[model samples]
Target: MEISVRTPAVEPRAMWSHSCTLDDLVTPYAVDPTVVARLEAGPGWARRWTAVWRASRARVVCPVPDLADFPTLASAPVRSFTWQARQRHRPGLQFVLATSRMHGFESLEERRLLLALDFTGGIEEVLSQPFKLRFTAIGGGEDHTPDFLVLLNGTAVLIDVRPGHRVKDKDLVKFAAAERAAASAGWRYLVVTGWRRHVAAGLDALSARRRPMADRLGLHDELLEMVAERPRRFGDLVEATSLPAVARAHAVHLL
Candidate 1:
């Protein structure tokens, strides 16, 4: 007797955020027209951005005027990483299923943000340390690099990761500069303070089944058929399956 194996099913994107809590995690930054004009005239605005927008190995110099129409999804990180001894911050790489690439992160909070973005889905591309942003804020000349540049539904979103309490007065200045630049380029800006209650925990649990899984026993189809009628409690849904123990993992994948 011969047994045939089927290809594994792709893991569905996790929708861990609830409607009520989405606002708490994502905070948009807006500014008045005067500040926007000042930022555009500053050095950061006059200076070109260093990015790899065309080829993976080649870097492109982009002017601020061209940013609104730049194809960010095709871009690469502005700079690479080299770890040194006793670094105060934790630096690591995370493999994102969305882009099938290992993204670099300078800190643990960045790592979590990557996971959340990956699970959220609809992101075409994610580039770490995407560009070197130089802007003159109220204080004086300030040079900064944003954490990540993500393309969602063909729109560019510039993101910075900083805990609410950790954000100081100077940090706000840099953020404001970034926000203004991002706006000038027709891109959205967001400061992710932190996740809402239970969102992190839920993401952890769902990520366990984030990879492809083989339905050797045909339990995936059976599980779906069972839930076709109406929504069922997770515990009860798994318990009603043909093989409850194995179905638990499949059920989570189906979610």
Candidate 2:
């Protein structure tokens, strides 16, 4: 069965000529194959050589609650019209907008629809798609559904979302295995922990204090403080941190 899922739409307004530069237009998202396919399928579509200033812009139409509701935008205004006339009236073509003015995107395949959702709607579901890849530990195995897993810069990785926890060694092993697989597979992994400060203060007594620890770099003051006092348990982080939104990544490093 062929799946023709609508691609994530771009907010072209953020790419104004005077405001945007050559580099912004060259990134992976800007020239994504899936994105380009959708654009080329539009009327008057041209792959211009004049660069970004003259390249055709993608539509930025009225906002509805979701991609399924975007068709409601066609009846608005002509100036507001994106492919305003006929394409919107096509026999069978779907247009979806899963855009944000403040962030970047990292899709998995050249042409595909990925997991997307709004708050309170994201639930843990099995990898129903056969193409969805996951790592298996040498023997440890995966957990009560991972906290989160989705694509980024074309890689699939795990995310942690529990607010706080009394972590178990078994959970740690599963996470460690996931990390190792991600590295070998060239995917990114992340473990976002919260409440570092409180945990740190609590661990200070157990730590071998070095007057001023060098582990204070890059982390939030709270987390840095915790690490400064002593080593931390992975569970401490689970208790403190919240999982990142499906569309927004919390961590960037390889697992």
Candidate 3:
């Protein structure tokens, strides 16, 4: 059987400045409280966010690409992966954005990292498998398609998720090409890994606060005062709010 491959016919334009840093180019995505509340109330909230609550809040800095002028990758053919029967049993996830559109994930890891990014107070937009770019001139040229394209603060980031142990020689070449493509476009490229453990728990804890009910019950202001005064346990913080048990529970989550 004959198989055909697609490639970029023209070289992409170099739009990004060499001296710009990721932080300077892209800001983190902002949280939408309404959207968070909706997701929290939806079915399977816990399952969806298992890894999100474990990722860290540390800012990631790198070179960014300029994606505004590039064509969307949606036109590219979808790529397929071959895995053993055991791997096929892994569940997929769908992320619902503030806009109510859904972005699908093929693995739990991808879903978790995406949730973390969504929960991040700094990220503004998240797109999955947005596009593909070719890196070589030969037949059946190598192509790099990032897993997610996110708009952080004000900058764009092209992210790829993989386990730390799975990164190999070929992956390095692909990463290098991705880096070059991202830098040229004034966007940042990221290879996501086990770092979700750093921020997920904190995010899950704070997600409850995104509900407007927290504001209505005065839990918002009260918790702020208590935490600002001195460090307190989550339970104590909840009790200090003077809210009822249910409200206290919500307040505790906010803390």
Candidate 4:
């Protein structure tokens, strides 16, 4: 049997372009063939991706199985951590405007992913170490914890952060289980192995406008009106605006 993976419906955009959505910015890493083969080894492995791997059948603690009940489910992170010296991975807290709180990250990659998420708008909340997933695999019962749970535009997204080459067979199994768990909750799941081409560079450039700036002159509308007619190169776009020097900052702010 041939098993196919679900790919996110996101489009790649240029660095200066404001055409992409939050979903577009957070690109999913390419699937690995070895990992796919390992996940597809078992007889019923393909079917298991849609199964519920919750805490239990009686009590649903992870989140709501329906989108309507999602709002009523209030939650804090299921796990906590303490910083220690000589650790292999860097752990720190970053203040995200979307949540209006400091969210935790286990590694630099995770931190970067958080920044990318925050850079895009419409992120309602971000919780680190959201819940403990109990899954039944061919091997047996295994528990796994996801990195982050992001509520974007009334939709929940479960995210796991691991480098592309660092993903092992066990990791694939856990991610599959997480996907199943997310599916049960009417949510989307993403395994962020790495960024897409030019995304890292694009994000870094866009970071300059991440924070708010005073636009007393209302250059945002002017720039929007100018760009609406046609796409312009970054340099030319700013120059064509009413106040060339002032429009430069607003141009990036619009992005």
Candidate 5:
């Protein structure tokens, strides 16, 4: 009996963000905040954001522009940086703009870091490798749909293939719910964006099982325990990590 191989689903491309350090891109427009508010939900797989604009009246509002001001925005005001990070979070893209003024608030170096994320695409490759499980790549499914609900080792893993960037409340909620559910299910859950997107310069096949990720996530001992003890589902993992949402899901995947 031939076990016909199944294809992993193809994910859609929504409005992913683009990072920029340009100060001229900042513009405070006046519109009914409802639309902006709805858009401010940022990009993700959820469909409820439309309702937010339905009840909103045409009110004058200043929407913080996209990551156009990320470079200068950090230097301008922490509040501005935070706001941009929240508004410009595209579901598909990384929007990798750093608001940190670390290392004596250096400018050139920060830009370089941001540039590496934008051009080199390191985050997508690195992050994607750890989140995936071994499976035959029989390509099928919708091109415009969100990632398919994946089951690895009999555990559900919800993947959102966005790039590395600031975390938002909406995205946080989905990831959080997955984390909560995984803890309840004692399963593995992950949001694999960035790093993998760029293919880590196409080294995915070579370094798919790299070991450094365990150290980065700080999940060495916990992983050892879970595999040995065997979690039943999400709930078990949650209890094991005592972690909530994305962090919890992350811990489960680490194992």
Candidate 6:
């Protein structure tokens, strides 16, 4: 049997230009120097803390979309990845956005990042390759397309994902243009490169805990209570439970 789902509708906005300074992109959130100083005392803390701070503070300059715009934005056409297979058949993955459409990702990296985004407790909605934002560049008018448009904490964020090695001078210019556009719209902008290993792994493990059997057997509540008392290994948690061997294995898998 075939199932059909309706794509949400979005209203089109007029294109406009906005300009921003380098400093505007430098710090998206206000920073406390004292906290930074304390964190800097630890080995490798400065670098790690700096990255976290930048990501957290990344400011949006775009206007928050009203509730009505969600359906339209969620229904936006995903960028085609058909050309990608011409070079090599890298397996693609699709995400079921909060809006309920299957949004495709061209690379495993993008998929992993999407998982991370979905696991982010604060994210309200996600729209992939949502819309084009036009901006003025050095010599002419240019159009910039961000990879994802995210709504969190009642604000909008424009995200572009690129690996560090592939970032070029021209790409920086494009990002600058995108940043300005985001600022004008009262939204924040982010250029995501790497994922935090622990965060990604934890979310992946947590996502696996959604099996119906876990709930039916009361293993879900038991496991949560055990973990809350103190961190426990998967094997230990399984052993602690009175489930049969096969059931124990399944429970561990869920954990």
Highest lDDT among the candidates is held by which one? 1
lDDT of 6 at 71: 42
TM-score of each: 0.78, 0.24, 0.58, 0.72, 0.23, 0.59
Task: Arrange candidates, best lDDT first.
Answer: 1, 4, 3, 6, 5, 2
Q: What value of lDDT does candidate 2 attain over all alpha carbons?
A: 0.28
Model 6 agreement with the true structure over 1-255: per-residue lDDT tens digits: 221222224322332112322112221222223322321233432122110001122422222222223343325433445554366434455654444456666566566667666434466767666655444444544555677777777677777776555555556656665555455456777876544324456556755653345346666566667768997766787778767465464654554
Preferred candidate (lDDT higher): 1 or 5? 1
Query: What is the TM-score (0 to 1) of candidate 1?
Result: 0.78
lDDT of each: 0.71, 0.28, 0.51, 0.69, 0.30, 0.51
Compared with the true structure, what per-residue lDDT tens digits does model 5 show for residues 34-59?
A: 32233223243222111000012221
Model 6: runs farther than 4 Å from truth? 1-75, 83-85, 88-93, 198-204, 208-211, 214-216, 228-236, 244-255
What's the C-alpha lDDT at position 46 in model 1?
Answer: 42
* Top of the candidates by TM-score: 1
lDDT at 124, model 3: 65
Candidate 2 worst ten-residue window by lDDT: 46-55
- 132, model 4: CA deviation in Å? 0.7
Worst 10 residues of 5 by lDDT: 47-56
Off by over 4 Å in 4: 1-23, 26-73, 215-222, 241-246
Better candidate number, 5 or 6, judged by TM-score: 6
lDDT of 1 by residue, 114-196 (tens): 88886666778888988777666555666777899887775778898876657665666667777866876788888776665
TM-score, structure 4 vs. true? 0.72
* Winner on lDDT (3 vs 6): 3
Residue 93 lDDT (model 3): 51
Q: With candidate 2 superimposed using the best TM-score fit, by how many Å does residue 154's alpha carbon deviate from the native?
A: 3.5
- Best to worst by TM-score, what's the order? 1, 4, 6, 3, 2, 5
